[model samples]
Target: MDFSLQQIWEHTGLFARFIIFTLGFMSMSSLIVIAERMVVFRKTRSDSRNFASKMGAILAKGDLSTAANTNLGKDVGHLGRVINSGLTAYRISPNDKDVAVESVARALERQAQREVQSMKRGLGVLATVGSTAPFVGLLGTTMGIVNAFQEMAKSGAGGLATISAGIAEALITTAFGLLVAIPAVMAYNFLQGWVDARSVDISESSNEFLDVVARNLTGGETRSQQQAG
Candidate 1:
């Protein structure tokens, strides 16, 4: 009995076919998530670089008043969003006081968390597929072998040859499962590492912005005190 893919699929029972279909869907879903995450990360990294290069000096100088009124071109990435939130908070603040820095810090933190969470979207699907695909494949194989045994018993067949087709069909599901799972796990790990690295970058940048805000507020207060005296 030939046990090629076509032969196995053609002779596979409904349960086995369904398992194969499920693995296929999982593979496709992982691929889509991997592609989407890659694109998002690529765009975000580029935008963040551009934003940092162009806006770092202006933002560090605490020129929030001018920056708030200016159009910060589109797609400044996660860092841009966090910076803009801080700027907005600063603009609304009444004065260069402890209150202003505290408020801006809160805003930056909130936006940073939001950006990290947003970037993590669709990663759950990859994790789920990576972790569970093998079990799903094993389920199909188990059922396939059981069905093969049942058929053998009914036919009174007592040789490997009798169940070879059924065994092959069952094993292919496991192969398919592993084939689907390995890449998904690898992709998940790689993307997760990228996300972690970006998260750290965002956190460090937010802290730097906070330092700038504190210094700007303190400097302004000192200038006012001297002028008033």
Candidate 2:
């Protein structure tokens, strides 16, 4: 290669490709987050609707098996899983309804935390790409500029044409990098917010379900017993 501006562009293109790769991965991460959120939404909605109805019925009839299986069958989402965990725990110690409800709530809370962690998977990578991709592109741009300046020094040409190619390469690389980074950054932020909100919803719903279970199990029995004693 004569090491001209065109040569520099060719090399810059390769660097641009690297930026592209980073952006592509970032896009995939965003998509994954979106998919997870969608799944969570659907499952949470289904769980909330069905859980209350089924649980109420099960509790009314004192059918622990159906209630327990309802929890198992719910694909409502992470929150459902948490609710199910609590319900199952309660089922295991049906005699101590108060203690069982409390134990299930704790277990469900822990499971909810884990599910929240799972929902956050790959988010860090997206954030890293969004925050650092531009810098990576700038690195390539800087390299291209250096090469251009070197050519200028060697050519001893004092015209815009002499450096135009190099300048183009530099600008192109930088622009491409920004293009890659901006969307990745945006998606990362959007998805992060969505994930946090989803987790909150899960926690709230799980807690509410725990309350329902507690109320059903105790049913003023504890209060009446304490008053009697």
User: Across residues 104-176, which tens digit of lDDT does each residue of candidate 1 receive?
Assistant: 9899999989999999999999999999999999999999999999999999978998888889989999999
Question: Pairing residues by index, what is the TM-score of model 1?
Answer: 0.96
Off by over 4 Å in 1: 60-62
What local lDDT does model 2 show for residue 153?
Answer: 95
User: What are the lDDT scores of the predictions, listed in order?
Assistant: 0.89, 0.70
Q: How many backbone clashes does every candidate have? A: 0, 1
lDDT accuracy of residue 72 in candidate 1: 63
Provide the lDDT at 27 for model 2.
56
